[model samples]
Target: MKLTTTSRIAGSAALCASLALAGCGGGSGSGSQAQGQIVDGGTFTMALNADPGNLDPQSSAASALFTISQLAYDTLLGVDPAGGQIRSQLADRWSAAGTTVKLTLRKGVTCADGTPLTARTVADNLTYVGDPKNKSPFLGTFLPAGARAAADDATGEVTLTLAAPAPFVLNGLASLPIVCAGGMSDRTSLAKTTAGTGPYKLTEAVPGDHYTYAIRDGYTWGPNGASTATPGMPDTVTIRIVENPATAANLLLSGELNAAQVTGPDAQRLDKAGLFAARTAAVLGEQWYNQAEGRATRDPAVRLALTQALDLGQLRTVLGAGQATPPTTLAAIEPLACPGGTLASALPAHDPAAATEALKKIAGKTLTFAYSTAGGSAATATAELAVQQWKAAGITVTPKPQSGEAINQTLFGTGDWDIAWAQVNVNSPDQIVPFLSGPGVPDGTNFAGIRNSEYDAAVKRASAMDGTAGCATWLEAEAALVKAADVVPFANQQIATYGAKARFETPGQLIPTSIRMLDR
Candidate 1:
C-alpha cells in the first residue's frame, strides 16, 4: 500500500549506460529528466497493467487508479524533484502547525468544467476523503482519520484540523488528489471519467481497454509551477489496459507503446535495446496475514510459524526472477525518508522444525493464500512456490488467485483471505501506519485487521515529532511488527519504466507534467 496497490514490477531492471535510441543517450536519473532539446505535438501511449475499474480519484489508492489519477487530478502539494522538500501545486502557499495545516489556493485556477476552484471547494474535497462514512481509501492513509477541513473563499485558504498530530502530513497531502465539488457531489460521475484540476482531462473512457486524456489548455498550476503549456508535452495521452507483460514489452520494442514499466524476463532485452527508462525502487514481495478473529492466522504463533516455514531468500529470488534485493525497510519509494536497516533483526529466521511443531498443535485447518494476478508471471510463480513451501511445513494452503480488484475486495470487503502477498509501496512511513494499525476494512483502509500495540504506540510517539525527526521510532515500529510476525517484507528492487521515443518522470508513478514526447 504505499495499498499503492501498483503491483510491483517482478523483474530486475538494473541501470546500465547504453547507446539507447538514435538521438537519446538517456537523461540521467530515471532518464525522464529533460536535458537537451524537447520535441512537441505527439501522443504518449502507456500500458496500464490493469483497468482502474472505478475512476474516482479518492476511492482507492490502488496502483492502477493512482497512476491514472496523477494524470487527471492535481494535489495541493507535490514532492519536489530534489526530494524531501514540499512544493506548491494547487495551493501556492501552505504550512502546518501542530495538528493544523493551511493551504492557500492559487488564483486563476479553474476546474475542467470551467468552474473556479476556490479554497472552499478544495476544503470540501478534503472533508469528503476524511469522513469515515464516505469509505474513501485515503481516509486514514493520507488525511488523518477524523481530520476535518474548513475554507474561506475571501481568504483563499483552507484550514485542516487533524484528530491527531501527523509527522508526514504534508507528504501525505502531496499524494491526495482533489476533485471538483460537482464530481464530489455526484460520486458516480467519477467512476467513468475524471474531474480534477490537473494538466490533463479524461476525454474518453473504455473499461478493460484504454482511457484517453487531452491536455488542458491554459493550465498553469502544476507540481512546483509545472505547466501543460511546456513544449514537448504530449497533446494526447492514452493508457492501454494491457494485462500481459510480454505483450506490453513487445509493444514497447515495436514502438506501439511509447512507455511501459517492464519487469518481466523482457526487461533485460529492453535494457539492451537502449530504451530510456524512469527507474525507482519498489517493494516487490510483502506478505500480509489477516489477523481477524476466528482466522487461523489470528494466532501469533501460527503467523510466526507460517513465516518461519518458508525460505524467504528463495522466495525473494523467485519473486524477482533472481534479481531482487533484500528490503531495507517497509517503505521502498525514494528518496528513503528513513534510510537505515530494520527488517532483518526483527524477521523470524527460517526454521522448519519450529513451524512443523506449531502446525502439529493446530491441525485440520487450511489457509487461504491470495495474491493479485496483475503482478505478472513472476508473482504467479512466487505464489505457487510459497504454497509448496507451506505444504512442506504441514500447512495446507489453498491458493486464491484473483484479479487485483477482486483481491482488494476480499481484503477490504469480504475478509476472505487468510494470507496475502500485497505490496503497499509508499515513500513515507506515515502513509503505511494506517494499514498496519487502525480501524479494519469496511470502515477504514486497515484491510488486514492488524492490531499490534507496539506498532500503535511507536506510531503515536513518532507522529508527535516533526517529519523524519522521529525516524528511529518510526523504523522501530516497523521492526516491532516484523518481530511479532505481523507482516513480512522480503524483497525490494529497482523497477524501470522504459520509454520508446518518449521521456517522462516517475517519482513514484508517472508525473503527467513531466511527460515529454521525443521525436525519434
Candidate 2:
C-alpha cells in the first residue's frame, strides 16, 4: 500500500501556510481572497510532461499511465496520502486469514456503463492480472504469483487465495486498478476507452494532445469518504501533454494551465512567484545490469568492478544538484513500507584501484550503456560521467540515448543492452520482490537475470512475517544482493509539482478527490 512520508505531509503543510499567507495579503473586498471558499463549475487544466502511452492499466507500468489511469478507475482499496493506511474504496471492508483474503464490495457502486460493480467483476480483474500470458507488468509486482480469485455473487464477497505467503497482500490489492467486465473482455479498446467506477469519466481523449474527463455526479464512494459532489470540485478536468518543462511553466504563468510538475531552474522561478508546490522524494540514480548471455555485465566480478569504479558521492552531488539524499533501498519513495539501515553498510565502496584489479581478467571488454533522456541534460551528463568512470577501470563503453518510451521498449522488448539506468520507485518493499528475486525478463520482472538462492530464501522468510516486522529480514536480503553488485542505487531527490490559478493537495501526484477550482 502507498504510505505518506513525514516529509510529504510537511510539504503539504508548507503549501497550505503559503496559501493562507496569500489570503491575508490580498486586497480588501476581493472575492478571490477568501480562504477555503468553494467555487464550482469551472474547468481545471493540467500540464503533463509526456504523452501517456496507453490508458490501459494492465498493459504497462509507466508512471504516466498510472497517473492518468487514476482519473477513470478505482481500486479495491485506497491508500491514504497522509498516512499509508489502507482505506476502503470499492471494498467496504476486508479481512485476511492465512494466505486467503476476503473483500466485500461496497453497496450501490456502478461502472461508467451503468453495470453494477459486482464481486465477480473484482474476481475477473484479479484473475486477469494474475495470468502471465496477459503480459501485464503488474503480474508479480502488484498481483501475487499463483493467486486465484473466487466470487460469491449472492453475498457480494470475493476471496483471494495465494499460492505462497505474501506479507503485503493488502497493499498489493490496493495498487491493482479494477477493470469492468466489458473492458476486460475487449482489451484492445482499453488503450483509448475507459470503463471504471471512479469520480470522473473519460469523455474525450486526444492522444499526444489532451484528455478530458467530466465529473461523475452522485459518486459518494472515494478515498476517505470523498465525493464528486464536494463543493469547489471541478466540473471538468483536462490534461494537456506538454513535454517541455519550461513551456509548461510558461503556460501556468500565462493562466492557460492550472498545474504542472516541473524541475530545474524553472521550479525555482515558480517558487519565487508564490505558486503552490508539493514535493515527493524518489530515487533518481539506479543502474541495472542485463545478465543475459554474452553480455559483459553477466560476470559478477565485472558488475562489482563497474560499481566500485565510480565515486558515488560525487555522482550524487552532480546528478542531484547537491540536494539528493543517499538512497536506502529500491523502495526509497515515501510512506516507505520498510525503512531502516539498509544502505549504510550494504553498498560497494568507491575504489578505482580495486575496480581495475577486479576487471583485470576482462580488460578492454566493450559494453553498451543505455539511459533515458527524459530527465533532460542532467541525466545525459550523469550517463557520460559513468562511462568515463568505467573507462578509467579499463573497460570500453558505448553510450546509447533513448526517449522514455523508447527506453521502456528497448529494456523490456529488445533486451539489447548490457547496462541501463532507470528509476524503480515503488510504495513498498514487497512491490520490488519480483524485480529482485524471480525469473528473468521475457518471463519476470527480474530484468537483471539474477538468481541467488540465498537471497530468495531470505525473502521467503521475510514474506511470512507481517508489516514492519519483516524490515530486518528484507534489509538483510537487499544487502545480499548489493554485496554481490547486482544493482546500484545512488541518489534520491524531492520532485516538486507547481500550481497557479488553482489550489489543490498533492501527496505524490494530484489527488483527484482533493482538486479544487480557483475563483479566477
Q: Please give the lDDT score for candidate 1.
A: 0.76
Candidate 2 segments exceeding 4 Å error: 1-38
Per-residue lDDT, model 1, residue 165, is 84
| 45-120: candidate 2 lDDT, tens digit per residue | 9876555667886676655566667778888886665567777989998987778899999999888888889999
Candidate 1 per-residue lDDT over residues 1-520, each given as its tens digit:
3353335111111111000000000123444322435788688899866667789977776677777787888888877645467778888899898889999988999888898898888888888887778887677667887788999999899999988888878877887888987897799999997888888899999998899999999999986678888999999999998766667789998889988876756676777777787777777778889999999999999999999999999988876777888878876677667778568667899999999999886788888997766566777788888899889999899999776656666777788989987777766787777678888877666778899999999988988888889999989999999998898988876777888888877777778888878776
Q: List the candidates' TM-scores in order.
A: 0.93, 0.89
For model 2, how big is the CA root-mean-square deviation?
6.5
Residue 367, candidate 1: Cα error in Å is: 1.6
